[model samples]
Target: MTKILAVRDLHLAMRTGEKLVPVLRGINLNLPQGEVHGLVGESGAGKTMLGRVILDILPPNAVVTAGHVDCATTGSQIKSGGRIFSNRGRSGISLIPQDPMTSLNPVKKIGKQMVEILQLAHTGPPRALQERAEALLAEVRIKKPKEVLKQYPHHLSGGMRQRVLIAMAFSSEPGIIIADEPTTALDVSVQRRVLRLIRDLQKERNTTILFITHDLGVVAKLCDKVSLMHSGMILEQGLVSEVFHSPSHPYTRSLLNAIPRYDQPREKLAPVAEDLQSQLIDEARKYDQQRQV
Candidate 1:
């Protein structure tokens, strides 16, 4: 397990009127190659922002006041946006965005879009490229792969489009991929299929993945390591077994407690107590202020 990606003391903020509202506070992460690391947190905890920063696709208003990202495959430390600006690390980090419906072009045929993407990371005759595209679709377990190749994004179901996105993400054979809750919009069965496909392809490619989601079940099923985030900070992170089996942080324990277990069916899901949530935020603020010293 070689170190593939490392994020150190990362602090990111967004512009709000005349102020910079900090979103990621003193974040630190280390990802070994060929592993799936889960980033589990409630919305607005800076989970997606972390993924965006790593992929160099942060929003236009984003301000990276501090921190650096180190990728072993890209040949240098990424202190800022130089790698993405210079096209050095662009091809090495791919993203399977949350929305497959919008990730692909609505007007372009799937084959054309896929071909263009494949050409970014490969080159050959047009026919060969098309064949490779279809093969990728097949690899994701889409039936009638050739027909899918000729269709438009709107013509396919949400699940099919997601599978195509997964295929495209791996087509680049990138060293790391950020899957930003790719299953959010899908039904239960479709989500399972897509998760299985992603897990299988990840194993096949041996690519490190930053899997962002709030579902403990998904984390347990797909991730090797888990980082429980809250208020833009990692409250706890360790092996999935250790984190889920015995969560130490109050927030982490509350998150696990919120999950409904079939083994011990509950009348109602136990939301994190309001007082506990407030205490967690206070703790995060204290930690953030400490880092400023």
Candidate 2:
């Protein structure tokens, strides 16, 4: 399969005062066209940082030190040393943020927000934009699209707000989407429904998605390929089935063992071992030292 996005030996760091702190180290990843690739890691593992790098939304203090990010969809390449090359005017990327509550504008009506997004890729009269917004809401399976459009973000349930974001994400028909822990704020049942809706939309449009999350179960359910990240490094990556059943890295195995299984309800859940955590930290320190020299 052809790759929609690729990151090669990417290194990123943040400048704190006079010192530089590494965030992503020697990272390499590829997202094939029309596939769901999961980036799974615990907090502070640099998973979200990687996504931010791809989206070119890094913090002001962040800097790309080495390697490059290539997006075939946008015909653009972001290189180290602060060089960016683009072949098109608009980046063919969109984002579905983690928190739906804060992602949408509290002061703006749903219709206003949706039309604002549509206006970027479309130029038409108010009625045309309104019709397009209604169609997009219906596509996400939202009921009474017109009524929902006139309502505020606070008036809708969590699930409905998430659906509106999803609709906005696909409204531009973007070639790639960065879904940053989109289901983390939702309940279990709502999470499942939102996942289904995303998967269905992805298949219908053949869109490529980079799904970032910490949940192994969600990865198993939604991802075709998976990467396990820790301490700003990719510990292991492969087909979801292969990685789940036969994790190659010690960290990966430990993470899988930590998940509670319904079939083994009586079995005690195991946490990641302390010794292994110490070892990994030592390894990361050594890597940082080597890079510095």
Reference-based lDDT, each prediction: 0.87, 0.91
Q: TM-scores across all candidates?
A: 0.94, 0.96
Poorly placed runs, candidate 1 (over 4 Å):
80-85, 288-293
lDDT of 2 by residue, 1-293 (tens): 78899999999989999998988889999998898999999999999999888888888999998989998877777777764645242438888889998999999999999999888888999899999999999999999999999999999999999999999998988889999999999999999999999999999999999999999999999999999988899999999999999999999999999998888864667899999988987888899999889
For candidate 2, give the lDDT of residue 55. Answer: 82
RMSD of each: 1.7, 1.5
Q: After superposing candidate 2, which stretches have Cα over 4 Å from the reference?
A: 83-91, 265-267
lDDT of 1 by residue, 1-293 (tens): 79999999888878888987788887899999998999999988889999988877778888887888887765446554444334655677788989887889899999999999888778799999999999999999999999999898999999999999999888877898999999998899999989999999999889999999988899999999999888888889999999888888888888888998788768656898899878978987787678679
Tell me the lDDT of model 1 at 215: 89
Q: Model 2, 220: alpha-carbon shift in Å?
A: 0.4
TM-score of model number 1: 0.94
